[model samples]
Target: MPLDAESDAIGTLLLERGALSAEQLVAAEDLAEGWNVSLVQVLLARRWITLQDLYEQIAIYHDLPLVDLEADPADDTLVRRYDPAVMNRFSTLPLHESDGTITVATSRPGPRTLLHIRDLYGPRSRIVVATHLQISAALQKAFRDRHSHDAVFALAEQDPDMSAQQVVTPPQILVLYVLLSVLLAGVAFAPVPTLIALNIFLTVFYTGNFLFKGLLVWIGGAAQETSSRAIAAGAALLREEDLPVYTVLVPMFREPEVLPILAQALRNLNYPLAKLDIKIVLEEGDHDTIEAAERLDLEGVFEIVRVPPSHPQTKPKACNFALRYAQGDFLVIYDAEDKPEPDQLRKVVAAFQQSSPDTACIQCRLNYYNARENWLTRMFTLDYSLWFDLMLPGLERMGVPIPLGGTSNHFRIDVLRDLNAWDPFNVTEDADLGIRLTQKGYRVGVIDSTTYEEANVSIPNWIRQRSRWIKGYMQTFLVHSRRPVHLWRSVGAAGVFGFVFFIGGTILSGLLNPVFWAIFGLWMIFGAAAIEPFFPLPVLYLSLVNLLAGNGLLIYLTMVAPFRRRWTDLAPWGVTVVGYWVLMTVAAYKALWQLISNPFYWEKTQHGLSKHTASELAEAKAGGPEALAAAPMPETGP
Candidate 1:
């Protein structure tokens, strides 16, 4: 194959590299001839088979002795007891076994004699339990080695890159539904006279939402009086230097489109590059991402940690895998689509600097970056503006264990490790962890920081993404509420109220949005047939006033937030906030249904596919990775 003379060099290299022996390599080459591709390609094409594997008895065929790995004598703790009985639980993946020497298969060995096993066997071991994920990873590797996209590797792990804004309770949908439902139900019981009376429902719903928000804010403020005053006065309730180095773990799967954009945005973060630990985590089989990451000169700080293949393909497992190598003092997870305010790190630093040692976490705000993208983006932005700017603060004020948003949550590294990092089995591991933190008597503070991310603009993509979120909320609710009264004692009354309004309110809104939408449509179509939906001075004025007030709040918050971050451009979406909520209603409904049906499935959002002009692409190509940062969507507000 190597013109006879060079064949020995190739074999020697493989053997020296411990990839394979000369005879075994020759036999592999012969077996690989059936692949119609290169030897490595063939090795990849063959699923569940390790590169080091002597498949089809290549060793025996070459008259070589079986490799007995156990005899190597690397006695750590577990290896000290590497008899064979412990491995009996999992597959006895024969590494190499003899009377004196018995090699085993777990790659991940730990100090403990038994738990947290990394796979000892190579990636392509011959004797593997044929899990579907293993099959998928193998297929992906083979595809990458052959016919992958020009941007496939780069875009494979593309994400919107940020978390959603803080959450709100008794959403517009729930109030609207209660309003129309009460009035309409009353009207149904009566005659034409009751039709006009149905209007009371709308008033009640509006008043209820406002009243609920006001009351909760009041209660939270009262409870957090001391802390609020301290924060407001900028007194020594915290210190900045005390905060540890923070690592934000971002996991991506098949989101190659905006990979460059996300990396660039992160590079532009306020945190010092040396102090910041960013893990651009990828699934072990995601070679496209790994390859795409190769050319970019990440100066050691931003390392690519490949998630060893695991399934139900989870966010937590990726974090868990990357956590092992994290040298940070604290940890956070950011979505790929997030564009956090530049000074966000500064705020967190300040907050953590002054807080008590047990204050191990600081939750921040998540706001949409593209609130003005369309009608949908606008409503979505408004919803978020109210949540992060209003609800989460209120919740924090009340001292509740917030059902943590999926991203932008900071954690002390030691605290996280004490809790074993993220639970790989928990889908909404963030929420679960938050609850656990409270239960453990660790305090979580709030940082007035906003991580801007793209709202789901497309309907299908929006539904997929939103559904996973809703399902995760459901998971969080279930896991934490399992011990309800115990939780109440841990978080207190104000916290309980906050959880009901914020977390429970989310599930409620998703369930009730369609009902209200249906009623509003019916009133316009039938009940108010003689009356115009958008007419009459008083009605129009009231509607205008409501819309104006909502939009005004959004504009004010965005401007204030960005001003604090020194990025005034993001504040402009406030004007169009009214229009954005319409889109969220649609997403809410889809999320509700999917939560009941397919909870764990990730709704993949496609990025970079948005049409960029030839010149834009040219500019992008010219700047290489840096110029390609972030989507060109308007950051200006409503």
Candidate 2:
């Protein structure tokens, strides 16, 4: 509980090893701005320590307990010979006991911890060590290996893993109950009048979701223009060339098919090749991907970091592993399916270069390139169009922290690393990082650059991925709300409102929008519902207006997306966007259920690299006759 008791275990060991004086240790502690990063980071920044020296210190520091073991006369000589490797092989830590079971801490603990413990301890030794940092991890791995498997199963609820489940409704119990009460309360005014009030409520809500989206776009100004402006500002804010060298780490798992496409896309970034520190992070077990990279020998700009075999099984862990070696001015992440534009790096640089010191991240546009591939893709594309092109800009215009999507997000390298990079435990690390940055007095803004990606059209595939996204959003909401008063004070009322609009509103709308749609469908079928719908004639008329405005936006998106790509002929698919809403309603429900059942599960999306309509993509890429002339597929019946 006390900081110092556990704080400088290594620092004291260094003093004992003659690697650093107590005075030097104190100085290093004083310089470590939040008392988090290792002393080596401070010493390295000051050119006082070398990388080799740092690792050597850690190795010796770990050997301190062994030294202590040797000094104790009462200790058995066998204890002095106790192998650290035995514990490492078992993935155990040696935590001091306070209660039922103690934790064990060891560096580089492999996955098969139980087998090693059984081998060394002869299934008798109960004492174990775990990673010094993660106590929970060690306890589970060790206890599960040697102790009661049934007990672990009984404790499942304590840390039950959840994957995003099938989509369902949002948290509308309270809101709906209140609305229903109001409906009943208004019944005294007569059925027609009560119907009027109910109609007013639904109409206002339906209109609100639409307006909230439009408001984001209006406030942010044109997304494209804002992006272009950000190019200059971001670069200037980053101090342009004066910006520190930065690394961009992209972690891949089971993605050899999309790897080359991703590589080609990142290669197009405007950042100087020499200055661009791009690390293609890969899992240790993924030999096929490692082989593929080696075979490609994909230029010096791309470096592959095979994660240490012993790592938290998460994307963030892969990133953190690569981050240990990253050397750059800033860092950003892009998923495998992303196709960022050639000018995106410049845009991000401009935003940082020109923005205030408080700014920590700049989230660029993310839209699907193959949006017209299927009905699902079209619906997904529209959702993103409304989110990035519309909602994000509004948040930026309001000067709030926008919850960043998973990829094409840029951040100040030092600032990001200082915040512990990403949480390996958090599945939606990007969203969590956004909230954390905002909590820490940092700003998140929208940049103009657009990163195109593949949309999940397969029903199951889309469900899995969408569920994860919603679940992550739920985590973000919970994580931030855990400190509501603190969050409000830091981000202010407007920022908090923006947060609600983006996070709470998204989930709520997912449910509410469907109800509203259901009512409309009923009215369409019955010519008037059996239950007298509470709606004013004016509001009813406005609903039609809302419907038209909503439908019209489809045309806007198809036309708008082609502003640069100039696929004017394909703009006709905008009409299909109307039918696409039904798909979204279904997806939103699945996403909601997933939020409840599997909040942290990342339903993997399988990509179809085989859908490489090279001629079409080339045409889309050029935005010219060669590209445009290739033509889009004729409208298909789904």
Candidate 3:
């Protein structure tokens, strides 16, 4: 057969053997061209043919020996002839060496790879056909030691300066403590002036923060209108064979109650089953979840990766370890209780195809499934709706850096690896990664897809979750601010402004909220004349406007959140969002204490605590795409 016919021979054989229908072959061919992947890969990804079927066809076509790495392992001495990186790059393994000829097993033994092999082992080299999985397994075993180390945490371990958990530098802490001491001394000796100065500074700060937040909300609303129009135009469709492999990493702690439900939700995704790579990352110490997962007897595509116990056991660290074993071209992260839309993966695939290459990540919206469970859940749902639906889209529209939501973030595997994956020490690894990507000249976009999660209904659980988030935000702010000039150069002036206001302002607002609330309360209740002198006309006006309009705008934003979801029944509760902020203040103080005392400690948030989990899971399983289609837009009430 001609060289061109040789490449097409496998497809022809598959068709002849009745393994693939004529229509499937034609569709796969078209997809192979579009995706720039081989016909076998397309067929395997679509599950049109089994690995054994493809291997048999390839062996017949190539006239080479077939090897199964699992049954007949490669000789370690032969494998050691080439570096692991080179082996991975070529997708080939050295099987054996004898009589000055080295035998190599490869899935794609094309002329180019053959010639490369000949160049490495001279003209006497022999080639063999092997399944991709076999070659991958062989290579993995050969490089087991090298692959054991987590690339995600390697940078931080090598350079302590890069660790995000070290929120404040020693020098910074010293200066801050010294300044606080001086301020307290001044308060003791010169109370009036100190109080007046503090009030003036805080008033201006609050006013600026209020205006900045208001601007984001306004821009977000406008962006939502434009996005709706774009969505109305319809999205691009992806053929079954053109859909690439997608790896999903779900890090779980001791919450085994939701494992079965989580498995069902993932299986419900509207994608090719053969192309899904879902890894359930569990801590080594959490044998209960591991046992639960084992009991489920998950499908071949679903795997449970037990992470070895280490210092500062964190979700990101678990993700980092699992990432090393991922084989997909694209990947995403999901939380334990998350029930993403069935078409979310398809949406992300289409979004990536439509976006520029520089768009490294796409963040999907997150809302609570148990929004109506209780008052806390309602508020939690509103907060998510506002942040994901409005603020993130606006930031994407304006080309500003977005702090990624913890879940539903789709990423290109190559880009993610190039950026060193996630910061294991950053509690909000997703958020830190978003900034790091931007800093490296990559952009993050917002998608229309949504994932439903169980909101923490109990106040204590909510506080634990919220405080970790606040602490993470604090860490993100401090890490990025370490080199202001470099950050500005990377993201430009507008990006810098957005980061400071969005990230820095968020942390500062949480920390300073109680102080301002106290002053307002004292002014209202005491009618203190001494306080009047401290608040001059301008300061007094700004403070009053911030207290009234700023808060009113916040409440209005909360109300708007429910409108997107068409949950009008919850809109009336937006007024009660102020009480929610009070709760946030409590969490913020707790976060502050943790930040100072135990910055690296991860306070685990208990999931599966919502009363509506059973109902939501049932709805999710029954509803599928139809339910998601009828679902209202997400609304965050923060």
Against the true structure, whose lDDT is highest?
Answer: 3
lDDT of 2 at 76: 23
| lDDT string, candidate 2, 330-442, tens digits | 88888876767766777677677677898888898887777677767766766676677666777777767678888988988778766666655456778877877887789
For each candidate in the order shown, give its overall lDDT on alpha carbons.
Answer: 0.54, 0.59, 0.79
lDDT string, candidate 1, 1-638, tens digits: 22232233334455665666566666546644432223432333322244344222333233334333323322234332333223422323343334534444332122331232334433333332222122223222323322122111111132111111112123434665897887777667764445434334443444344445665544543444465445534523323323346677888876655566667667676554435667788887888877776555444346676665544467776776566556567787888766676666666666676698888788887877555566556556555655555556666666777667788998888887666555444457687677678777888777666787777667677666666666667665655555568779878877666566566666655565455456556667786554443334455344345344633543555444434334455466555643444555566676666555655555666544322323334655678645655445335422
Tens-digit lDDT track of model 3 for 1-638: 11246547888998999998999988877766655566765665554566688788888888888887788889976787687666656767888889988888887788888887887766998888887656755665665545446533575766455468567887677878998998999899998788888888878777777777777777876775655445423344566657788999999999887776777777778876567878898887799998988876555567677776776778887787677668788999999988888888887877777678898998999998778888999899889888998888878877788999899999999998776688777887789889888988998988778898888889999999999998888888888887778899999988998898888778888888888888888888888564687887778888889888988998998888767767788888899998999888888889889888888788999887766665544564577434534444333222
Give each model a TM-score: 0.58, 0.61, 0.81
**Candidate number with greatest TM-score:** 3
Q: Between candidates 1 and 3, name the one with more favorable TM-score.
A: 3
Candidate 2 wrong stretches, greater than 4 Å: 1-203, 223-243, 298-301, 308-313, 368-386, 423-427, 457-459, 533-565, 613-638
- How well does model 3 score by local distance difference test? 0.79
